[model samples]
Target chain A: MTAVVTGDLPVIEAPRSRRSGGGNGTNFEMYAWIFMRMSGLLLVFLVLGHLFIMLLLDGGVQRINFGFVAGRWASPFWRTWDLAQLWLAQLHGTNGLRVIINDYAERDGTRFWLKMLLYTSSFLVLLLGTLVIFTFDPDITG
Target chain B: MQAPAGTLYRGREGMWSWVAHRVTGVLIFFFLFAHVLDTALVRVSPDSYNRIMDTYKTPLVNLMEVGLVGAVLFHALNGLRVMAIDFWEKGTRYQKQMTWAVLTVFVAVMVPATYRMVAHTFAELFGSTT
Candidate 1:
């Protein structure tokens, strides 16, 4: 890449450095990229499976009453499926956001505060989602 | 123009992926809010809830459903991409290739899934005979 030097007289060649680490290396960033592809593949299956069961099977959307949810959750199979989906989706999504925060937030204080906020919100959502799934009371009459 | 100090660009793949992640996250959050409110309507009255759900039975709602599913799939898959970037040392070299690969996988999985969702909704709302 070329850049304009001071005085605006001529274009100057940008310094090219082929060195790997400016003391930080590129290992972490590289690993994050690979994770995106791999997790992406898994998410495709988990998410699609979820949509199919929830939206298409049985009587479709019309049949998805409280009783239906209760029935499904009562089974270990459905519980495990839900648990896996919840954990995978949350971890994947949160980690993705973490990368964005690290890349964009320039100031240390900004980065720290933004990450703290992200972590807090992510934790809250994950906890609430898990709680609702497990402690869902089907019988509202009591 | 005088060149600014430090890195000019952090490359395209990372920036684009970051943008996509934020967009999808916002979409998912909006959908979750609507979903929770709609479901909570059931607490008011079953008849009211059914009426609310009947609104979702429409074609427009079905279209939104496609978008919703797409958002979830894209976010999840791209998230995996972000994770891979964080973990692998060689990931930087393959960032662009992996991004394309993620898009390919997303299309492969999403197109069929969307087709089925639309077809099922059509069948439910208009009947299969139509």
Candidate 2:
């Protein structure tokens, strides 16, 4: 197979995983791109439903309190719904920022640090959020 | 190193749209951070959660909510536009059209929502007894 060259500069193509950044042995960028699309679609429903229920529905924000939340969490449906929302939104938005940092940050050190921070914070939030959703006890009388 | 200049405004609609998408995306992400943190307060204590939420009921916070809604709606619609561009064969050729379509939908959805959100705040501030 012949290589096609379009630009003046000589081009050398590397392995997809290598070129895509310090990823594990996988087509991570392709998966990341696909994840963005899929998660964005899911997030539209999850987020809109959340906003509608939390801010725009019957009694609206005025009705939200600890009891309201405890009641909602009492149901498995809302627990799962909120869990999905937190995971999907956090992952999707974090990946978007990763792409942005990749595009804009000029230096390798800067990119590395930025991603380290991003991944660290994203992990913490996701962990904290998931734990909170599942382990919340409404009847802790004190 | 060359200093960055102000030619960002001169980019095509696609570039500008991408810029706006990135901006809105970042805004939503930060908001989500705060949102989750506040929501997590429910686990900590009911009074703390309710107190934090009550602060969000102010007119100032309500106005910010309108802005948040605009950001989220625009990001969602434009995200679809971006997905099309990435996945569809013909998407690149008609990106401008897709962007315009996104903007149209954004305005259509956001206007009524903004009106309702803001109007409710105004009504609450002025009292329903008037």
Candidate 3:
């Protein structure tokens, strides 16, 4: 408000905007938003196909067991499919729940702690799932 | 408290679809957390893994699987509607229609899928493999 030109219609300084970038000049939220769409598009295929085979195809849930998993994972195709699915689904779900927490969890500390727990659990799932896919023992039935 | 002037979303098909999307997404996310854990059980003894999976094959749990398939199918279909709304030039103009289209496709896919899954559950529970 201080600086003004001599006669140029009383120049005024612009006030700061009410809205701000995520406090850090990075498009993190934008990326997360886009990631939801991208991963969601892929997951429609991965997950539904998975559901079809696991829940609708042959004998469905009745035939699912350790031997079935070992048989499926024996193929590289299924291994990669499950691996990609595990990663994409967890990350997509993590970002999604994070947004939900931000919206519904009114308290600042509550949101923070809930998100910490979410990240911890998501990380554990990802780690454990990846390991299982890689080191699956097809002969565990023996 | 009130949108006296007007609003784009107006609590109709669009708003309800948004609500369903969020609810199903959260539900599916929680399920996925548990699903990964169950799949990981294979790394343990087969006895432990198959023992748990035996529970999944039961009657009540199979019904839940039907519900799960419905939820996932809805989420996947409506997600495409969202993509259309976000990316297509005429999406906003036809969004309500697209929502209907999503549901139509959802039911179309769900009917046969549900039948097949339920048939399997019946056959398994009654000891007639087909």
Docking class of predicted structure 3? acceptable
Higher-lDDT candidate among 1 and 2? 2
- Show model 3 residue runs off by greater than 4 Å: A1-18, B1-5, B123-130
Global fold similarity of model 2 (TM-score): 0.85
- Sorting all predicted structures by TM-score, with the top scorer first, yields 3, 2, 1
Candidates in order, TM-scores: namely 0.61, 0.85, 0.89
- The Cα RMSD of model 1 versus the native structure comes to 6.7
Worst 10 residues of 1 chain A by lDDT: A3-12
Runs in model 1 with CA error above 4 Å? A1-48, A56-63, A76-142, B2-13, B37-52, B123-130
Q: Which tens-of-lDDT digit does each residue in A21-75 have in candidate 1?
A: 4648547766766665665677678777877788767545656665666678788
Error of 2 at A96 (Å): 1.2
Could you give candidate 3's per-residue lDDT for residues A27-106 as a string of tens digits? 79889989999999999999999998988887888898888887898899999999999999899989989999999999
Candidate 2 chain B least-lDDT 10 residues: B1-10
lDDT of 1 by residue, B1-130 (tens): 4555334325466678767879887677546545645655544555555677777767788788888888887777776676666678976767777888889998997787677667866776777873
Segments in model 2 whose C-alpha atoms lie over 4 Å from true places: A1-25, B1-10
lDDT tens digits, residue span B80-106, model 2: 888888889998888889989999998
lDDT of 2 by residue, A86-109 (tens): 999999999989999999999999
RMSD of each: 6.7, 5.3, 7.6
